[model samples]
Target: MAEVRGRDTWTEELASLIEDSGVRYGGDSPPTSFEVHAPQSESGESLKEQALGFVMAWCEILMELGRGFRDILRQNLINEDSYVVRKFGGPCSKVSKRLRFLNDFLPEDRDPFHAWSVVFFVFILALAAISVDPNREAVAPVVKVRQHPPSASRVLLPDGRYMAYHEQGVLADTARFSLVAPHSFLSSRLAGLPGVKASLLEEYGIRLVTYDLPGFGESDPHPNRNLNSSAMDVLHLVNAVNVTDKFWILCHSSGCIHAWASLRYIPEKIAGAAMLAPMINPYDPHMTKEEMKRTWEKWLPRRKMMYSLARRFPKLLSFFYRKSFLPEQHDEIDKLLSVSPGKKDKLVTEEPEFEEFWQRDVEESVRQGNIRPFIEEAVLQVSNWGFDIKELHVQKKCQTRGILLWLKSMYSQAGCELAGFLGLKHIWQGLDDRVVPPSMMEYIERVLPEAVIHKLPNEGHFSYFYLCDQCHRQIFTTLFGTPQGPVERQEETATAFEEEDKEEVLQVPV
Candidate 1:
């Protein structure tokens, strides 16, 4: 009784104080007091109380429903003049008046439609529980990466950024031909044509140059990089590396976007393009019905969704990329890329050598551990490339599009000129590739009819490109006719001196 009186006194004092304050301020009177009642279970826990309430509420409702069902069942079994019995059941009963149902089996207790509906609902609920990712609502990662220094051979670009690069085969001056190979997504300069031996390159006299994309590997990040900037970067790289003559652009998978950009912006600098399992824009407007169907059907639904997200809502890409690749513990390549690999691709990925190389290459790729560069790369793959593949086809174009240009073209030789890239394009497509479907190759062939397509049977996206020396040799032979060996760089100064001093040579011999 004393404790209750003390509590009541405290409540009264609080109420009086609140009333006095409200009156002093000339405001509306506040609530004198409020009670916070925490409904508790028998065990004195609120959560258990909530669970009990929830179960009881559902049970109460279901019990009523169950009663109604029971009444209906009883009517159907006992009442002969029920609505359903008088309708369809009458004729059946009349025809089977003399017949009897087997009592061994339970009477029809379950309605087929209702039972199936319950099963379907349960199935959908289970799928919803599985498919609905909670991370979709998540914004950031828990574990963040700290800054780390570069770990690759670097070059200074015009943009004042260091580009990481790797040189294979012969020296630049001794190179008969230069091949600039840009790596695919989640790869670095270290990924330059895996399993391609130095002897093979020397035999062909080809200088194979591979470089990291901006912000990838040990390279400095570009603030506002795009396709045009990508082409400019490659141009600067080749010039920096002393590639004076036009060079071939080699590509694999998504890396072909850079090659396409080079062909569009700096066609004069590019001699040819060799693409293996090249990726095309999924949202390209020029795709025909059959092409779109065949191309889209080859990919899993998740990949299509990812493409749509990258193309339409690129801002959302950071979230997904952060979840997959930005962290130290990342998803598998297929899961990260949302690719459904075919059998050959699975075999290639499962190889011990492929795993080792892929792990190292991926580490080098995400060395900087910055997500913006990856976001930029993903956006570049699906967004407008500023030029179409058909534009690379050799064709004549006027300085202007109208009749003034045409009228001038009839008189002036400079009014019109050959506009498109005149170089040959060699595309090697794996027929069983799931990442980049063969239909994309078909589309490329359709647009640029001059591009020759070589089909690889039973090969996958990675099988032919990853670590197959035979495939590499075949690709080399197809692009470059025969192994010509390294260039015999005749020393111009030495030759000139020898020619001018033949008398000295003759006197010394005597």
Candidate 2:
């Protein structure tokens, strides 16, 4: 029974299995005992003993699994009383009692039971206890799981100080959803050199501070955590790194969402922001689902199938998924998934830590006993929350596109709305073939005409990693004349990611 529960991901199915198993065992126990007194053939006696042994073994395994599960839950800080104690009581009690009963059966004097059963019983119980309280503070080692081939040729920077370096957008680590490493390239061979360090100190005089978004990299996973809150966490990290001065911001693809959103809310603290293949929505917020369907209809034929397969076989297809990002279109998907206006390129695949995050989510939902439809509803809620933010404050009837437009207007107007507000001297690089359509960039250019747009021909989405040297040169030029500003520090008060610079604008009547 414990094995049955542990094997299934859903709570309902596991609960049902436990229920049925308990009922069968409960009803059959007396009959089985009565049959033990049969004066039948020796074969019948042997069969009865075998059946009893099977029942006992099954019960023992169930008890161990239950114990192990309980340990995992408690260690993970999941309150088991929320679900098991209140909702699923019978099974839990049965498992505990059976294990206790089995303890007495372990003695050699009692029917000469097998020594292995006793050994396993002791091992499982001990393991359950150990696993339940296994150091709550344990941190997983960071590993690089993927990198681009050409990026393998670039020299890697040292790890001691905060230095700026680019990652060749390969899914290298399984730590978080979309953790772009500081200087991890495709090649382990090139990482030995202090190339990234030299570039940061010499070329830009900037220190490198790396971070993992909530569901990615070195950060803890919060499956139900809101995106706005998660984005704020990135800003909080800036203070934690002791960088007390305004720093240049650069982001690729989906990362641009948080980067841009940060700049929008806290424009004064940002010296400049450079978005490579940044994700921005061109659609209006009010567009209907049908309209979105119509807009995506062209890609729907392929995208739906891809989404289905990716969901079904996440582990097997993760490699191919990374490969799909072209050299020039690294930031393309970020823009595509940016359902929020100005938040394009938001790809779900960037979150390698999703599984760990979801494990916590599952544990919590199970504990709450609101497991069955909650998982399905949670996915939709995640989608809608991000989508709704993009269309905030639109009085017009909401269409899918209109909704996004309304959100864009509200979000953009709230920030620095001055003429030179977005004057970052940005050198934008975009690939036409990537997930973000060329049209999205054109739209942003229309709004912020001052941004310098550089289109990389013949490259797909992720080509920026290969063009690091050129990007570095452009950034170096921008940093040389711009005097370094004093770092603005903030208190580590709330996990709330408040913008460092929150300037209020006074609107005057004409």
Candidate 3:
């Protein structure tokens, strides 16, 4: 009886509302109480009045919807099989329930789970509790890594500093050619033209010497070090190793700065020089617009930004170095350096042998875990060098200082001799090298016209020079001509190269 009464009551209320609203099955005219009015221009309705009208219209529509829904609910109570009742009891009723439940979960304001904050609060607490390294406070001489076991030979300099060095090829006393190679940035004594084998070096009768720079590998750090000090260190190393004859200097990439110093300060000690993809000051004032454009374009934007920072704002580098290199930054080495490797370079770096050698060398380079040495090296690359590249050309200069001396020179000829490096200068360039652009070679040729430039059409920085035996043979043959066996020990006149001799007396300054 109650269900029948409820259905009858809902039907009567719906019929009365529809009649009052003047809507019927025949589309009959609305009642006198209902009126239609168009908005008038003269009325000039304000923004607030227009907003009120919109709100009133929405309220009427919502009231109608509410009535419809209420009638449907009454039908459900009476088991009247309405559309809403059919949907509620549909086959997918469980799926609908799941959807509604999910929609209510993890809401921003209110949650029924009562456990959402548990994970978040626990995460925050765990993060606060974790501390891998408790000591963050740093002072002078903060070692970034544990001290490594000594693996290289050490030499004590006059300045009470120790230098680490490695020797390869034939015995120094029986060598026809002695090459003193100062390694490039992020390298140590173990990097002697990397891929060139021991037997090949023997066939050429070449004694190769490579050494770690200050604050690198097993070498002691030099206080207030510069390029001049760098050259002097090489000079001290050679004297320590006992190269009886004038030795050649080999340079690659930015490491050429040290060799350039050797050429400038101790020109008399060097026999000749061989440079491969040698880098000069990118910020050199002598660079032409075209040269600058080509050189700077090869680097990625990040690399360029880093170089700019190193050039202008060097003090900020420590913060970056600490985060990257000091904290075991082993991945994407070339990317960090802002260099894009060529196809050949990529192939070489991917090899297991090359990868192993490179990782070990890097370990030795940052073994001390200090950043100052790296900073100084970066600054030196762009800083003012004492001499110019033009000074290296073989030319004669006869100059009189004073007016009187000039007048006297008119009456009598003055003594004039060769003014620059008289020895041979050979440069090997890889065309596809991205680190040192081909424009750099152009600049070198423009300034020092006498330098021999050997262009490798398809070679890259590492591919042509590093660990390739055929390439090594070609380089040796080009430099020394046909290979000859080691010279007799009696014929050698170089200083004694004994393993026990670690210290050399500071006889003559470089």
Best-to-worst lDDT order: 1, 3, 2
In terms of lDDT, the best-performing candidate is 1
lDDT string for model 2 (41-115, tens) is: 855887999999999999999999999998987865446555655666677677566445445536556542456
Candidate 2 ranges with C-alpha deviation above 4 Å:
1-197, 281-427, 478-510
lDDT of 3 by residue, 1-510 (tens): 776567667656866875544333322322235343435642456566888999999999999999999886686653546665576666556645644543454666755344546756895686566434354332122323344588898889999999999989899878999998888877787787887788888888899999999998889998899888999999999999898789999988888988888888889999999999998988888889999989999988767766766777788778766665666436445744667899989898878788777777777888888998888888888878877777787786655778886676666666456888888888999999998888999999898898889999988888887778898888788899998867864344333553224344444356
Give the range where candidate 1 is weakest over 10 consecutive residues by summed lDDT: 98-107
- Ranked by TM-score, the better of candidates 1 and 3 is 1
Which of candidates 2 and 3 reaches a greater lDDT?
3
lDDT per residue (tens digit) for residues 77-187 in model 1: 646767766677867776445223322223378655466567679978975885587873363323233434565677898768999898999998889989998989989
For model 1, what is the C-alpha lDDT against the true structure? 0.82
Candidate lDDT (C-alpha), each:
0.82, 0.41, 0.79
By TM-score, the better pick of 2 and 3 is 3
